[model samples]
Target: MKSLFLAILLLTLYGCDNSQNQSKPPVKSENKEQLISPYFGFLNQQKDSLIALPMDQAMESPEKYNYVIIENQVSPLGFIQNKSDNKESNGRQTAQNFANSEGSLFTIKNEIKSGDFGMLVNQAFLSQYKIEPFTKVERETTPEVKEKLEKKYKRKISKSTTVAVLKDQAEFNLTVFENQQDSALAVFSYIKEDQLINLDFPATYDDISTWRVDDGGQFDNEAFQVLTVLRSEAGISFVSIFWGAEGYELNFYQPKKDKFTSAAQAYGYSSPL
Candidate 1:
C-alpha cells in the first residue's frame, strides 16, 4: 500500500516534573541499571496543579461566574513556535514508509521539520520538499562501480571527476543546508540505509529536526551504539528505553528503559552494540 513506507525514528529520554523542576529532562538514577522493571509512576504536578487551581476557585463560587474553563493548552503551535524562535531553519512535514511492493519509493514525502516535547510538527513555511521517480538515475558512485556512475552522471547531470545519482534503493543520504538568511534547502535520494543504527537519535531529533529519520541522524558518541536507559522524574512515565537497529534508533519513549535493560541483562547481552 502507499501508506506502508518505513519511516525512520530517533530516541527519547526522561524529564522532570515542573513543580520541583521545570524544562529539564529527568535524570537517570544511579541504581536504575540494576533495576530494569517497569513498575514505576510519576506525575507532572504542574499540569495537575493548574487543573486544581481553577477547580478550587470555581468550587468557592466566584461572585461573577462559578465555572472553571480548563483548556487543553497543549500549544499545538508551540511545536512550530519553537523553530520560529530559533529562526535559522524552517520545519517541513514529511510522510514516509516502506512497502513490500513495487513503486513504493515514489511515496516518500520527506519534509523538513522540527519539534519540542509532546509531538513532532510539520510546518508549511519555507521548507525543502522532495519528489522524483525511483527509476530515475543520473549517476552511480559506489566504490565498486565508480567508473560506471561517473559515465552515467556525466551525460545526465553535472560534470564531475566522479558522480553519483539516487535511485529506488535503501542506500542514500539526505543533506539539508541553511545559511544565515534562514533559507533552507535539502537534497536527497530515493533510498539510503545507514550503517550504524544506534539508540539516541529520537530525543535529539525532538530537540532539533523532525525530518531526522533513522538513517539521517547524527550521534553524539559511540555510546549510542547500545541502549540508553534513563528514568524521568518529569511526569507519568518514569522510565526511558532506547534500542539500536539498522544503525539508527528505532524509537524513544519513557518508562520502558528499565524493562528493556532487565531483559538485556537477563540475556547477558548488556554490553554495547
Candidate 2:
C-alpha cells in the first residue's frame, strides 16, 4: 500500500522491491546535505538525553517544547499538512502536538530528518553508518559485540539511503510550531509495504531481535539496536523497529539483574508509555 504520488519520485526509488531488484536503478550517491534526514528519528528517540525533558516533562502538553522536524520525507504523511474535516487523512486531526512541544505534521518532508540531524549524521557516517550519544550509552561492550552491532545497523538502514548508501537519498526539514488544542494526527501516509522486503534483511525487526542483546541490566526486548533505542525515563523505554512497528519495552535493573522481559514490541505506539 505505498502512497501514489504525482511526482513523488524525488528519492523513493530505493524502497525494497525484490521483483524490481534486477532492474533497480543505480544507488544514488548523495551529498552531505541529503544524508542528514535519517536522524530525525534520533531526536525523538534520543530526547531522554536532555535533562530538561524529564519523563514527566516530555509527556507534557503539546505547546511545551519548540522543535519539530521531518527527517526522511519519503512518505505522503511526512509532509506538513492539515487534514480537511470532510474526509479523514487516515484519521489525521489536522493538528497534533509533538514530543518537544512543537506540533507535528508528519510528511516525509518536515520533521525527522531535519537539517540538524542530516548534517550530523552525514559527517559521522563518514566513519560509521549510525551515531548515538556517549551519554545515552550505559557501558562498553566487547569489540566483537560493537562490530556486530555496527554491521547490523548498516544493513538495516540499507533500505533508506543517503550519502550513506547507493539508494535514494532521504532528507528532512525541521520546523518550529506551537501546539494546538486538537486531536492526534497522522503525519505521513502510512504504508504496509511488508511483503516487499526480504524477511532476512538485517534492518527488519526480526533481524534486530536476534542481534544478541546482553545490555547487562539494560536488556528489554522493546529496546533494541543502537540505530533505534528510544529512552524516556518518564514514560517507557522503547525502540521503533522494522520501519514503524510499535510499543514501549519498559526497562529496569532488579536485584542481581538475573532475568528480563520478552514481551513483543508494541504496535501503534498508540497507548501511553
Candidate 3:
C-alpha cells in the first residue's frame, strides 16, 4: 500500500508520463536569496552558524521554530521533482504547497549532545536511487557495554548510549519531547566532556493537501553525506552537517537562551570537520 501510494504521488508530482526519463528545466537560482529571505533573522552571521535553538524552549513555543518553512524556501520541496517551467518564479506556490504537503507547515532541527552517547539503527538505505541490501543495528544497553565505553572514552556515562548507523553515512534517532506528536526525530546526539550535542529535526506542517510522506525520518534519511561536530579555536562551537560533498548546514548553540538554531548553505563554512 505504501508503495502504491508513493507511486501515485510521484505521478501526481512529476507526471503520468516519464517521457523516458526526460529531464525538465532547471529551477531558477536567481531568486534563491529572495526565497530564503524569511530565514535571515534566525541565522548567526558573526559566527557563521545557525542559531543553536534549545529544544526545551522551542517545544515551549513550537510556532516560533518553523525551520521546515525555511528549508522549503531554500530548497523548494517540489524542486526535487522539477516539473515546472516558471523559470522566473520556479513554482513558488508549488514549493509552498510542498512545504505544507504533510501537515508540516515547517520543521526544526534540534541538537542534543552528551559525553556518554550511543545510537540505535532501525534501518538504513544505500542511497536515494538505490535502496537495497540495507543494514540494521540492534539496540543494546548492558552494564558491561557501558563499562567498556566509559573505560574507552575515560568519561562517566551520563545516560545509556545507543549508536545509530547509516549506510556510508551517520544518523541517529533520539526522543526529546515527551509527546511523540509534538516531537522531532533526533538525528544525532552525543556527549563530549561538558558538551551535550543533540540534533533534532521537526516536521511541523500546516497543509496536507499535497502527497504526504508517511515517514517522519525522511529529512535525515540521506539528507547529508557527513554529520560531525566542529569547534573553533576561539571556543565558538557548531555542528557541520554536510550534503553531497561541499554543501553544509551549520547548527549552533546559544548559551544565554540555552537553545539551538541552524542555517543552510553557510557562507564561511569551507570544509566539513
Candidate 4:
C-alpha cells in the first residue's frame, strides 16, 4: 500500500515528459483568478525549467519562479544523511512513509524570500499533527451561573466576560478563561463526562493569543458571546464570536503560530456547532 501510494503519485506528477513547448502566456483578456487556475498544467508545461531540486535548493532561488509545486509531505529531514546504519535504516523508512501520503499537491508563490520561505516550511513541518475534534455544546452562562462560577474559579467573574465549553465525550474537561487583560485562555483538564472523575492527562493551560476580540461598534461592547465553537475530526478547534455590528470573525487556537498542518483543511469546516 505504501509503495503504491507513492508510486502512483510520482508517475502522475514527475514521470510525464516536459510540456514546456506547448505552454504560452495566459490570455490577457482572461480573468486573473481563472487564469491562475491551471497551475498544475503550468507545472507540466514548464517541467524542463522546473528543476527536480530539494526544497532547500528551491528556496535558494525562489524568485526565479512564480510558483513552486511541492509534494504534500516533503520535509528537510528527507534530504539529511544519517551515518549510523540503524538510524539510517529507520530514517529511510520514516521518509518513505512521509512520501507515501502524497495524495495532495500545492503551489507556493514566492510571497516570502529565501530565508523566510525556508523558515515557513520548517514551521509547517513541526505542526503536522493529527487533530482530534471536540464536540461543541453551547450553553449561555447567565449572571447567576457566573456568580456560581466565581466560587468555583475563586476569582471574581466579570459580568461582561463570556464563557463556553468543549467536551471530548470521554475524560476531558475543557473550558475557556478570560481575565482583566481581555486575553482568552484554553484551560485543559481530564474528567469523565458522567462520573466527573478527573483523569491523568492532568490539568494544563494554553492561550489563544491569535484571536483578538474586537470590542467596538454600536452594539453592547461588553457582550462578546461565543456564537460558535467548531471542532474537527483532526482535533482542531475554532471559535466564532458575534462582535456586535462588526459581524462575525472566525479564529482558531493555534498552539504554535508558525506551525499549521492544513490551513485549507481547517477552513473547510463550513458549519459550526
* Winning model by lDDT: 3
Task: Give the number of the best model, judged by TM-score.
Answer: 3
- Over 57-116, each residue of candidate 1 has an lDDT whose tens digit, in order, gives 122211111111111111212100101112331211111111111110111022212211
After superposition, candidate 1 runs with Cα above 4 Å error: 1-141, 155-169, 174-187, 191-273
Candidate 2 ranges with C-alpha deviation above 4 Å: 1-59, 69-86, 92-239, 243-273
**lDDT of the candidates, in the order given:** 0.21, 0.23, 0.30, 0.28
lDDT of 3 by residue, 139-254 (tens): 54355545544454444543443444434333232322222443333233433333334454444532321111333333333433222222233222232333333323433332
Q: What is the Cα-based TM-score of model 4?
A: 0.23
Model 3 / residue 71 / CA error / Å: 22
Quote each prediction's TM-score.
Answer: 0.15, 0.20, 0.25, 0.23
Clash totals for all models, in order? 25, 36, 37, 5
Q: Estimate, for each residue in 1-273, the C-alpha lDDT of model 4 and write its tens digit.
A: 999999998877663534543465555775332111101111112222221112212233222224332321122211222112232232211122222222122233323222101111232223443224344333344454445445555555333222334454432233444443543333232222222221111122224212332322112323333222223333333222223222232222322222222121111111222
**1 versus 2: better lDDT goes to:** 2
True-vs-predicted CA distance for residue 208, candidate 1, Å: 27
Ten-residue segment with the worst summed lDDT in candidate 4?
A: 34-43
TM-score of 1: 0.15
